[model samples]
Target: MVRKPDFKILYVDDEPKSLRYFKKTFSSDFIIVTADSGAEALDILSDAGNNIGILIADQRMPEMTGVEVIQKARSFAPEIVSLLITAYMDLDVALDAINGGHIFQFICKPWSTDSLKIMLLEAAQEYERNRHCLILEQKNRELEESRRTQERFIYTLSHEVRTPVGLSLNYSDALLESTLSEEQREYATSINVVNQSLLSVLDNTLDYSMWESGKLVLHEFPFKLSDLLERIEQAFGLQFKTANVNFVLKRSTEGIDNLVGDPDCLFQVLVNLLSNAIKYSAAGKEIELSIEILKSSDRSVDLRFAVTDTGEGIAKAIMDRLFKPFSQLQTAREGSGLGLLISKELVTMMGGEIGVNSEQGKGSEFWFEVEFWLGSDSSDGEEPLNGSRTVEGIPILLAEDSAVGQAMVDGLLSPGIQRGDR
Candidate 1:
C-alpha cells in the first residue's frame, strides 16, 4: 500500500527535555520535528519548507511566545494546523491567536501524554478533512466554469441543428409545390439525408443527459470485459469505416476475463470515449484502447482504462477543466460539449475516477479507474467509492477559544460538566 502522506508536526519549546518527551510520545505516528525556541522553529520550517500538518509551540520563549509564532506561521503557511501550549493563563492573547491565526487547539502546559497524543491525532484527521474540502471547492469552481461554457455550447448546438432543419423544411416545401425540376428534386432528397444525420447528433446530445441523471440504467451481471469491447467495436465499426480511423484494443491480462459490474453503463463510457477519439482524431490516424488493474492500497484494486487518439490534442491551459461538465477542447467548431462530462459522471456512479492527459498536436488520452472486485476472494478486493462512507459514530474534539461556546459544547456533550471560576 502506498503510505498515506506523513503527518508532520513541529514542536517549539525552550526546554529540550519537554521537546524530547513530546517527540518520544508521538514519534511513531507523527513526524515530530523539534526546535529549542520560536526563532529556531521558524528557521527550521523556512529551511525545510515542511508541509507541517500540525504545529505545537510553547507559550514563553526568549524571542517569541507560542501565540506569536503561530501568528507568523499563518502568514507563511496558512493551512497548517496549529496548537498553542501555554503554562500561563493569558485569555486575551489566546483569543487573539485563535481568531488571527486560526489555531486548531490550545493545550495547557504540564499536559498528560495520553491526552496530548489523542488531541494531535484528532487534529491530523481534521487537517485531512479540510484538505478534502479544499479539493472539492476547486472542483466546484471548475464545474461553474464548465457550466458557463455549456451555455455557449447550447447556442452552438441550436444553430447547428436549426440550419439543417430549416433547409430540410424549405426543400420539402419546394418538393410539395409540384413545380420543381428533376435536379432540384434530387437536391431536396440530399437535404433530407443531411437532416437525418444532424438529427442523429442531436439525439447524442439528449443521450448525454440521460446517462448523467442515472435514468439510463445498466444491465448488471457477470460478463467478460472482452465481450463488451467486441460489442463496442461492432457498434462503432461503421463510424470507423466511414471516418477511415484505425482502431486498436489491448488487454494486459488474459485470466482477467469476467467482471461484476454494469456492462451497459460501462459500454456508454467506452462509446463516449471512442466517439470522441474518432471525432477529434485526424483522418486516417489511429485510436487505441487498453485496460489493466492497479493496486491502490493493500486491500483494494482499481481497474484503469484508457483511450488514446491521434488527433488534435487538447491544450495544456484547459487540461484542468477536462473532467468538468460540458467542456470542449476548443470552440473553433461547434459541439454540445457534454460528452466527457457525462462520461465522468457515469464512471463515478460506479465507484470510479476519470481524468485526461493531452499534449498539443500529440493527441490525448482519456482514462478512468474503477474499483475492481476480483472473481476469486483475493486479499485485495474492491473498496467503497470516494465520499461514500459516512462517519456513523466518532468523538468530536472542538477546541474553541470562546468560553461561552466551549461551555455550550461541553454542556451538550455532557450535561453535568462544570468549570472553576476564572
Candidate 2:
C-alpha cells in the first residue's frame, strides 16, 4: 500500500465556481480550502494558524491581488511555499507576485492536471532539500565543537601523562645498566620493558584517536612482500618461540613479491594479526602464513594474499565488530585493541582489505588481500605460488611524496623506474 502524503495545502480564490472546481480536482493530493474573497482567505488562515505547506493563490481578485494574498499568507506560515496562478494577460501580476510575495513558483491559469501534479511534486522535493540542508549545517556545527573537545583532551593527555612516563622509563633503563645483582638487573629490565609497553600503548591510543578523527596520514611506496614478511617474522619470532607456537609460510604467487605499496602499513597489518593470534592461541599450536592467487568470476584478472593464525576460534558475535575501533570483544585480548583497528585502517588506506574467519573451538584465520600486478620474471625468482608460473619483468611504476616513502619505493623496485609526486 502506498503511504499517504502528510502535507496540507491552502488554495485561495475570489471566485466560488473556480474554488469549487479546485476542491474537486485536488481533494486527493491536498487538503483544499476555498474562499470567495481574499478577506475570507485571511480569516481562514488566521483562524487555522497557517500550518500549511503550500499556498496557491489566484491573481485577479478584487479586494487583494494574488500577490497581496500570498504576501499576507507569508506572515501566517513563513515556511510555506507560495505559488500564484496567472494568465498571459497578467504577466505583470506574476512578476509582482514573485517580487512582493516571495512566491516559490507560478502556474499558468487553466493548468493541465499533469502540469499541476508535477509542480506540486517539485515543491515537495524542494521542501525536503531545504530541510535536509538546514539539518546538515546544524550537525556540522556540532561536529566542529566535538572536535575541539577531543583536541583539548589529547593536549592534556600528552602533557600530563607522557612526560612522566618517559622519564620513568629512562631512569629504569639506567638502573638496569648499573652495578646490580642478577635478579635486580632482571627486575630492572622487566620494569623497563613494562614501562616501554605502557608508553607504546599510550602512543597507540593517541594514534587511534587521530585515526578515528580521520587525521591519520599514509605514505605509499613500492615494497617487497617477501622482505616485509621476513621483517615481521623476525620481530615476532621470539614471542612465538617462547610460547612454543609453530610458524609456517606458504607462497603461491611470487608476482607480488616486488609489488608497489606501503610496506609500513602492510607490516603493521601483518604484525597486528600475528601478534593477536599468538596472544590468544594455546601454546604449541601452529600459526600458518600462506598466499594464493584469487581469480574473479570474469577470469581476466586476479589478486593475491596471506592468512596467518593460531588462536582459539572467534565467536560469531565477537567476529562481527572485530574491525571496529576501540571495540574489544572476548575474542580480542591481544594488544590495546587499537592494533587490529589501526591495521585495518592502514590496509584500506593502502588499497587493501583484511578479513577473518573462524569456528567456535577451532583457531581463527586473519587474512589480507591486495591487488597485485602480474609480473614476468619466472626464470630468475622463485614463485610465491609453488605450482603457478610467474609472469616476467612487468613494468611497475612507483610514486611517493615523502623521503621515507621514496627510500622504501626505491628499495622495492630495485631494477624498475621510480617516479615522485604525480
Name the best candidate (by TM-score): 2
Please identify model 2 stretches exceeding 4 Å from their true place: 1-140, 148-218, 241-246, 249-257, 291-307, 325-335, 372-422
True-structure lDDT of candidate 2: 0.70
lDDT, candidate 1, 103-180, per-residue tens: 887888789888988888788887788778878988999998897678557646766676557545444534534555
What do the candidate models score in CA lDDT, each in turn? 0.72, 0.70
Candidate 2 per-residue C-alpha lDDT over 1-422 given as tens digits, one digit per residue, 9 for 90 to 100: 44435666678887788778878887777666677777877777776554456778888889798888888867765556778889889988788767764798898988888899788878766656655776898899999998879876975686568766776675665575467797887677666656655665565666677776778787655556677877767555546666688988787764445555566766667766776777788888988877777763321224455555656688888887988866768344646787778777877776778888888777788887766443334435654654344233777776766565565445445543222111
Residue 206 of model 2 has an lDDT of: 65
Residue 333 CA displacement from its true place in model 1, Å? 4.6
Which parts of model 1 are misplaced by more than 4 Å? 1-219, 296-301, 375-422
Give the clash count for model 1: 0
Candidate 2 residue 302 Cα shift, in angstroms, is 6.9
- In model 2, how large is the Cα lDDT of residue 334? 47
